[model samples]
Target chain A: MKITILYFARIKEVVNYSSEDVVLPEEVETIIALKSWLSGRGATWQKLFDGSGVVRAAINHELVDDMATFDEGDEVAFFPPVTGG
Target chain B: MYLKVSVQPGDFDVGAELQQLRAATPQAGALVNFVGLVRDVSTDGQVSEMVIEHYPGMTEKALQQIAQQAMQRWPLLGIRLIHRVGSLTAQAQIVLVAATSLHRQAAFEACAFMMDYLKTEAPFWKKEVGDFGQHWVEARASDEQAKQQWKLPK
Candidate 1:
């Protein structure tokens, strides 16, 4: 399945890229599954998804927890929890 | 309920907003105003400007949800939530939440409560401009703790 991923706040700065479109394997069930799939790709992806990483997720523009599900044509965002008032 | 999320500039008359709300209804006995300023000191003392980024649609929706929550919680006569995005200087008013209610308690509590939620719940991103370079500040555990009070938040 193909989905567009958005990066924001600190995660955007660390990744050095704001957004991208990627194809994931069918085994990618939930957001946690997607994280594991991405990590195996390389060090850059792996380093960003470590257990201690502070990444928040959203599916299709709605704020969601890590367990959010996804499918083809989904718009998933990975961002740091907002600290601004 | 009124909401304004802009990237243009942070020059608005909050005082006038307060007065207008107060004069609009006789039931309003209290008006509460809060101004969130951009500071040079981050947790790491990152001294400089801040570049704020936001999801145009989602940001508005989240603020609107908060405003609706405020209305549901109290008898607010007027509510204004103004947030300025983009690059901002030190001490600039990044956010303003003005709420008016018939009772002083509800006005102050709801205004303060909305800010507490905004600090963690809003879809805002801030990049610190520093002596070395600009970078996004890390999300902190303290912010999470502060949001715990609103644990039952929808």
Candidate 2:
């Protein structure tokens, strides 16, 4: 399955990218699995999903928990905790 | 109930916005608005400029949901929420939330409710550029505490 991932604010700065489209493996079924897969890519990616940052996730524009599942073509975003007024 | 929610990079004219709402909803006896501004200083002194970023699609949706929640909770005739994103200078307006109702209490409470929700629910981040350097504004635990008060009783 292919999905679009979005990064925002400090996460974008740290990742050095804003958005990307990637094909998910069968093992990457849940958001937690997806994070684990991304973390396996390297150190920088690991730091993002690792317990280090206050990362939050949303699927299809609605905020969700780590265990949330996404379907093919879904848009998933990873961002720092909101600070807007 | 009437609701207007906007998330844009451009500035909004609060007076014009409020005037238009009032013109359209004459039955409303009370009007309340809250405007958030970029401050000149943070914990680190003397801020230069601030950059506000948001998830383009989700920002509007979150504001709409918050405005709808306010309408559901109060007898509001109308509600308008505008949040600005992108580069902003110190003292520039960042957001405006306005509510109208037949009575003062409803309007006041709804406006406050919407703002409190927006602080935590809205998908926006702020980076303050100061003499020390730029840093993303940290989310306040107090903001979460404020929004928690509105959670439906379990």
Predicted structure with the largest lDDT when compared to the true one? 2
Docking class of 1: medium
| For model 2 chain B, the run of ten residues with the poorest summed lDDT | B1-10
Clashing pairs in 2: none
Off by over 4 Å in 2: none
Error of 2 at A77 (Å): 0.4
| Cα-based lDDT at residue A75, candidate 2 | 97
- Tens digits of per-residue lDDT, candidate 1, B38-126, equal 88786666667888888766788778778788788777877888788888887777888888887888889888878877777778887
Model 1 RMSD vs true structure: 2.6
lDDT of 2 by residue, B1-154 (tens): 7788888889999999999889878999999999999999999878989999999999999999988888888989998889999999999999999988999999998888888889998899999999979988999999999988878897
CA lDDT, every model vs. true structure: 0.78, 0.91
lDDT of 1 at A5: 84
The candidate that wins on TM-score is: 2
lDDT of 2 by residue, A33-63 (tens): 9999999899999988889778899999999
**Candidate whose DockQ is highest:** 2
